[model samples]
Target: MKEILERRYTLTPFKKEIKGLKDAFRRASLRNLDSMRKRGFRPKNISYYEEVILGEKRYEELKGFSGRIIGYFCTFIPQELIYAARAIPIRLCSGFYDTVLVCEEILAKDICPLVKSSFGFKISASSYFELCDAVILPTPCDPKKKLIEILSDYLPVWVLKIPQDKTSSSKEIWLEEIKSLKERIEDFTKTKLTRQRLEETIKLIHKRQTLFRQLYEIRRANPYLMGGRDFLLVIQTSFYDDIERWIDKTEELCKQLSKEKTHFKTDEKIKILVTGSPIIWPNFKLLNIIEDLGAEIVCDDLCSGTQSLYNLVEPDEPTTDVMLGAIADGYLLSSVCPCFIENNDRIDRVLNLIEEFRVGGVIYHSLRLCQLYEIESHRLRLILKEKKIPMLTIHTDYSQEDTEQIKTRVEAFLEMLKR
Candidate 1:
């Protein structure tokens, strides 16, 4: 019965169109993939993320139970609201290069790769997004803010206005937006966001993030217990995978990791904190280079990494209002995204993390056309310079043309940090 329901739910009405798009994508992607492999850019979590992409393992099992899957893009959109409404929230951000060619044809050639891939995967009827009821996107960056207009033509879309300022005025405005989002969600699912349901869901999400932080804690205290690649796999998986199941497995890993002893002293390896644009799974270019150099990424400020685990919504009361306030306060106010205007907190947190994690330097990576991160890089540079911290910022796209260039720069950065 479960298998039948899953097959039925995922079956697309526009099968012919979907098939043709996918077939075209495969041919174009194979050529690029061969070159990428030749450049030695294999993703660290290929098997796991591939399974997640295909929706064949855990994602399949969960979608087997229900069809109310809500696809979301950024961490700014809370999952607890969807969970509280008795729907599965799956992250729909795309880091897959295979769809980039197909995407570039439809969208502008210079638009961000992430939007292109995500929109392409949707139109192509990819397994992960085929059955979603709606997509919730926050207007954080310019590309993302404009993306909803195009996406709404295909799917039921909800947009949340992310503030450009951290002022008291913006906080109040954002709180109202959260309220509007809740009402929109309620309308979409035909389910009311009750106090009891919201509280229970908040607890579940809180537990999940707590366990995620515990994994990071192990890495911070004993970097040998968890490598950079393995740590990121766990972090990225939580965005779309079943929250409760991910929590159980992460806690189990945390338990096993906690029992392990550090074979080497803290000074044995160069610890680093990574920041800038989100580096989703299968795009582990920066992580691959950094970890390959014997440096451990003790922490990061990426949405796909530590930022997802950075804040906890410690509500004094588990009421819906309190939990909503907590989510707004923790996820938005505490965020380090370059989209915000008054963003000194982002650089301040970087310096604090450098001291806390004893990070040797910061590697700030930005994808092409991502102006916010590149602009923020200048500000972050001034702060790092004053603090006398070594840093490097890399800019590139999905193509592996600049692999050697980045490798040389990373080697130089590591050497500088060592001296």
Candidate 2:
């Protein structure tokens, strides 16, 4: 009993090693300024990460500091839109490393773990909440919507609502909402989104997107020149880093990856489709686990992956209309994830991916206490089972504390499939 408890409670050597590597990478991210400059890595996404790091660094650098900062909650909302509007869009991500001095009462105990963690971080004086000027949350889930409503009193609040139905296009509805959002931002920042400013923003965004495509193409080439885990870090960094410099590093990496292949030639490997939420950068343990098991994650239904498939409007397309159209089409897809409201489109997406990839099994990962994914997992599993496809369900947190259990379950599932 003692041995089992110890093994379960104690962090594994492998986990520790992975964490150390990530820490080193993070430190490298901070120290490689000269190399980044030499490589002409002027990605705006890199700057985004730097800005947040710098925000915290600036506070630490100065003896005592206090100023306006903004917090944005939820993912896949195109925060660059907010940045162009002149407000720092800090993602409200947190974990167990927090003290809940202020957020406990407002957020409630039953709220989503990530939201609770954010509140705890705010209360604990983790510096994330201390610098927040406002909190913007999109309607990704019911809990999040409620979170935003409650947070309005505590801070400036902005709610980005996604259209509910995809059967009939809601282009006009979304366009109106964008116009309303524009008005609200103008009021909030006292900055106007002039034609020139919008154009500049578009150009910067276009450059970043182009670089992202190039990087992904390199990853997709046979033998996956870059490891899945490393590629995920680059993706996560791209989200918050300075886009231009990140682009430069990505371009360099692409040149290196071009000569390599993406596949492994191992026998008895199970080809799997990773079905679940987006596995963003800096938190790629899940994908690494799959690869380590001799299972290939050939495809994914993550927003961080396929969700960025649609291209932005052409330069000649009317800016307002194109932007609105892009937002609507992207968000209003039939395959929209359950984070908003689990609809039929998600099921269709599962079937489509399975057929397209010729996947042998599906690994369904839901973060611990992620209400949306957890609730939908059972139904998803039933559907897959009915289709005679093998499925594995694993729960995790961002910090990877439950990796061993997840791996055991995954191994067992793979073993069963082999028989």
State each model's CA lDDT, in order: 0.74, 0.57
Candidate 2 Cα errors over 4 Å, as ranges: 1-70, 86-88, 94-108, 127-130, 167-171, 262-269, 278-285, 304-316, 339-344, 355-358, 397-402, 417-419
Prediction 2 TM-score vs. true: 0.72
> Which lDDT tens digits does candidate 2 get at residues 1-419?
01101222322211001123224435534443322333221234344444434334544532232333457654445544565676555566543322222345544555555666566554444445556776666676776776665555455666667666544555466555656666666677778876566666667667766776676555444323433444444555544444556677767666655544323333235667776755543345677677776666656666555444324433565476565455445444533567544477777888987886577889887766677787887888998989999888777765546778878888888888777
- Worst lDDT 10-window in candidate 2: 10-19
Return the TM-score for each candidate structure: 0.87, 0.72
Instruction: Give the local distance difference test score of model 1.
Output: 0.74
Best by lDDT: 1
Q: Candidate 1, residue 213: CA error in Å?
A: 1.9
- Evaluate candidate 2 by giving its C-alpha RMSD to the native, one decimal: 11.0
Q: Cα-based RMSD of the predictions, in order?
A: 6.6, 11.0
lDDT of 1 by residue, 1-419 (tens): 01101222322222113455445434433433332333222234344533443344654576686548888988888787889899988888877666676667667888888887777787677756777888889888878876777776667778788888888888888888788888888887899999999888888988987787777777777665566666666677777677776777666676766665444454467887888888875667777777777777778888777887667877788767778888778778888787887788888888888888888889998888888888989988988898888889899776667878898999999988888
